[model samples]
Target: MQGISMSNTMQRRQFSVLACVFQSIFVALFAIFGEFHNHEEDKHNRVHANYPMFQDIHTMINDAGRSLVVHCFGAYFGLAAAKVCHRQNTMVVDDDESSGHSSELFAMLAKAACTTATFMLSSLADHLGRFNMAHIQSSSLAGGIAIGAFANVILYPHHAIVVGAAAALISVVGHPKILEKRLSIQDTCGAHSLHGLPSLLAGFLSALFVLLYEPSEYGPNFVEQYSAIYPQWKGSGQPGAHRDLRTQSFFQLAGLGLTFLTAIFGGLFCGWVMNWSLLNQVQPKPSYEDASYYLNAEFSLFGNIDNSGHGLGSSNTSIHKCGRIDYRPLDIEAALRAVKRAGIGPDAIF
Candidate 1:
């Protein structure tokens, strides 16, 4: 069966700004995250201090540079769209109608950048001998994120709508691979955040950029603009000014939180019956066949469990080889089932 493929709703140009914005945000979070990922590699018990804020600034700047190349593809895509006639090619149409073309263009650019991120991530993972699908689950939402976040942005009027149409056609050239991923919008690893975040952000920002950059040239009629919504928030219609930093920041936070919550719930709901799949929880099997037991016995020796229930070592204040060695059976199935039922599992010693 043929699969569904999604594109972020934003135009190419506007995507640039949003990619910049989101790049900044991703860097901040990843700085902290990267340190955590590498925490085990410390040289000594004294622990090396990690500078999150400084690291975030540096990481984001580097990520932005790489992402910029992807944004250029979006620009080319937008330019092509301006030559064609497609909804995705609003820039061409908006430019003609004197609507918000600048904003739309920026949004498109940002979306293109994110699209590039998705493709690059896929390719880089493989190039480095890593699984290409590491972010497959995250890609769908990533697509949506790009599209949705930029939804509020406006587009330009193209004297020739064919530009957008052509751009859409070209972008679709890679549709097959994206469709094959079998991702859902709500999945944390879904293209929503991975793609949706950038797509939407691009789309909305493009709308704003389209109008902001060339309001007199392509902004909507005064009546139409006011009727749409948030007159003061028409970031595109009014150029040379930025949205309140605080408000924009709040929205960004909300966007991240929304995704985080959705990811948590989606993962739980979709895999409710499954447990310990991520190894967050340690559970044992119902029965241990000799083959399986021997195979996994040594493996779980250092497995982490929340509760060991070893009774605080009250065994005559003496440590035996058995006591010292955390050689205990793990009830993987039961523990998993219990977690599914109550979100709680038995704690083990090892």
Candidate 2:
């Protein structure tokens, strides 16, 4: 059983590495061929026309920081997609004003706070007032995932908070009890709860915001601010002509759906390749245990070594150490037997 488990673990590790590499390659290819928004194209043309001498410098200064910050924060892929759809200039009416930045920051902070708070409360209720440290730690970042779609477009900080709280409740209450159980899926790392579901919720919120968007809110600069959203009215200089809210909403939802489909198909294909017999042949022994790969002289729980490199002068050497308790290689068998004798189940013994 242990050998089988180890083999599966090694296979999973290999699959993960290969999947990431292939996915990155595919994403890079897509980015190269992808269409740019009208505003983005116009901006590019303007940079080339006016800033010919410092075009490269402008690109480095303006674009590099945003990429670096997103990567550094390890933002979810879905969130990054949302950012691409609703760029800063289009998302905020007064991009030049400090109020715009302040509003965006406040929305982000509010969402994070709401998500963390809601997760803690829900967890406490679910666990009968006991908190799971792992869940708590992960929940702290769930808000960022939840708010990513509408982070820039959120009109009110409280709206961000509502989105965050809803995301947390869905993750805590719906994920384990409903999604996983009904679908018979095992989410070992809680990726669905932490990233997947929250991001989907964010996308929904983003679509809702798009539907609620009004051109009048931006006053005279509506065309300049929302050129990406309403590209047809860009050069026409008509702030009166508005983009159809339904059309924009449909596109937003469609993007989310396409992102999910691509991810799913890509993962399935990579997994299929990973399961080939040639790839599965090299299974590492003692797979899950760090002792197989690491040779550090860390503290052991089985026993303490004396100056003569012997475990309390006993011939039976220590396999590992566990706190103050000492267990010899031979004693492990006896301990298992003792545990069995005491009516302890195999799960408890292990």
Candidate number with greatest lDDT? 2
Please give, for residues 1-350, the per-residue lDDT of candidate 1 as tens digits.
11211122123324444644564566556544433122332333242323323232122111111111133223233322222211222222222222255654554454543344443334333423231332332342233323333233323222112222222223332333342133211121223233323433443343343334333322334223322222223353555334442444344444343334443454444444333356223222212222232322322333343233332222233332221233334456634643444444456422
- Please name the candidate that would achieve the greatest TM-score relative to the true structure: 2
Where is model 2 more than 4 Å wrong at Cα?
Answer: 1-116, 175-185, 228-243, 281-350
Task: List ranges where model 1 is wrong by over 4 Å.
Answer: 1-117, 128-131, 136-141, 156-223, 226-350
Q: Which lDDT tens digits does candidate 2 get at residues 224-335? A: 5455334433243665544366766665566555555555554555555655677644223222233323432333333333333332223454443333333334344544
Q: How close is each model in CA RMSD to the real structure?
A: 24.4, 21.0
lDDT of each: 0.33, 0.46
Model 2 root-mean-square deviation: 21.0
Task: Give me the displacement of residue 242 in model 2, in angstroms.
Answer: 9.1
